[model samples]
Target: MRVGDVFLKVDADQARIEVEAMALAPVPTPKVLWRKPPVLAIAAVPGTALGRLGEPSTASPAAWAAAGAAIRKLHDAPLPPWPGRGLDELAADLDGECEWLVTNGVLPADLVTRNRQVAEAALRPWTPVFTHGTDVDLDVIRAWSSLRSLLGVRWLVEHGFDPTAPGCEVDVLRSRM
Candidate 1:
């Protein structure tokens, strides 16, 4: 939840972990592996997760735009280096099936909650989509890039790759206003 801290979801054996990522708008944070070989990504969003909340109109347009810009800058930070598992790689390592759900035997409710959470995450930024003067720009990309970097970082840590070395901290997380 801090500026550069990464969140994730790891399995029981810790073999496969999924980063919490937004798949476009109004979508719950899903497990998306950024790389192929290592299947690394940001840690799955913390359970009971809720990204930026509230609607744009609740704040002034300028404030909303500024908030959006800040989020972009956060996502654009450079990722730390690590040994990671790509999505498929993790699946393969886990034998192509995750026992995370079955192990708990509450998969049905879990799936439902996952769907709702995805919707919440997607709704975070898209609230302005249907409003007047809603527009997207490079800042959006930067936000996403920042998110990707976090994913990369989570991968590194989950796999025992340390990124705390000097000059190894996250980059690209600049200011908005």
Candidate 2:
């Protein structure tokens, strides 16, 4: 939530990760204003969003290049104290979630299958980096997005969100296919 110049993030698990990552990251991150369990307040960065999901990016090529450079810097930084999931673990989670999506009728079987195939490219071993959970490979990024959307469909619906809404996860997945 944003209140003027401050953005308040509320998530016990994520708050800790964000705090630790911000402290360790070499690139610019939002300045920490204050933090409490389940809530972290940070001063807002002075820039419009580069783009919204499911929308064309209006940012200049320089902006995109800069963003890529920042990501490269983060990837080159020292590994975080905590470890992330191993390849086998991530594959298991992906397969399990894809099965759930199909069994629960959360998504069409073909859609899940295709995305799972795409996600498989990410299951290969790669050196770990200080990433916020997702893999660094472009294939893995796309795969993770699909998996995350599949996982969130039920939760979003339960919370009164329409997953089919324009620019939402479902739409994004459909567009990618």
Candidate 3:
């Protein structure tokens, strides 16, 4: 995806998964313009990112709360059709990665084993939700804010107005659930 002078490369399969997941999301997402295997075109939604790792947020408190609310809506939605892993599966994957790292000499065997033991202790059950498996950073927060802004965008669609308008568009999405 191109944002001004920067071109962001997305994995084809990952992008496809994200698009499919977004279809069921309660929050707003970038409009998919076209998809051609490795290349997917999407309309850029308005609004800057929430904040950088070490930077202060310029967005209002309400925007932050709205983002949280949006997250709650998503969490409350139905789980995807895929079966999530159990704790044992997670432990096996971790052990496998640690073994690979040690075999490749990426890390000392003792260190990997120690970390793996510690990590295994923390393994437990977790509720699965639709996630991009990426850290929630500035860009993520911005996207959430943009989604909050677009929640009511269905009204614009119903009124025959350009729903993508950055200005002069008021959306009011009323969730049935």
The most accurate candidate by lDDT is 2
TM-score each candidate. Answer: 0.27, 0.69, 0.46
Per-residue alpha-carbon lDDT of model 3 for 1-177, expressed as tens digits? Answer: 244533232332332335576787878877877665544567766777675433578988888877777777776777667665466755565556556656766445664554454453335454466653234444434333333323223333444545333322121111100
Q: Return the candidate ranking by TM-score, descending.
A: 2, 3, 1
Segments in model 1 whose C-alpha atoms lie over 4 Å from true places: 1-57, 92-98, 109-177
Error of 1 at 36 (Å): 29
- Which segments of model 3 are wrong by more than 4 Å? 1-18, 31-45, 102-122, 129-177
Clashes of 2: 0
**What lDDT would candidate 2 get against the real structure?**
0.70
Clashes of 1: 28
Model 2 residue 123 lDDT score = 72
Best by TM-score: 2
Evaluated against the true structure, the overall lDDT of model 1 is: 0.36
How do these models rank on lDDT, best leading?
A: 2, 3, 1
lDDT of 1 by residue, 71-136 (tens): 564345333233434444432433212233234442344432333232232223332321122245
Clashing pairs in 3: 152-171, 152-172, 152-173
Worst 10 residues of 2 by lDDT: 8-17
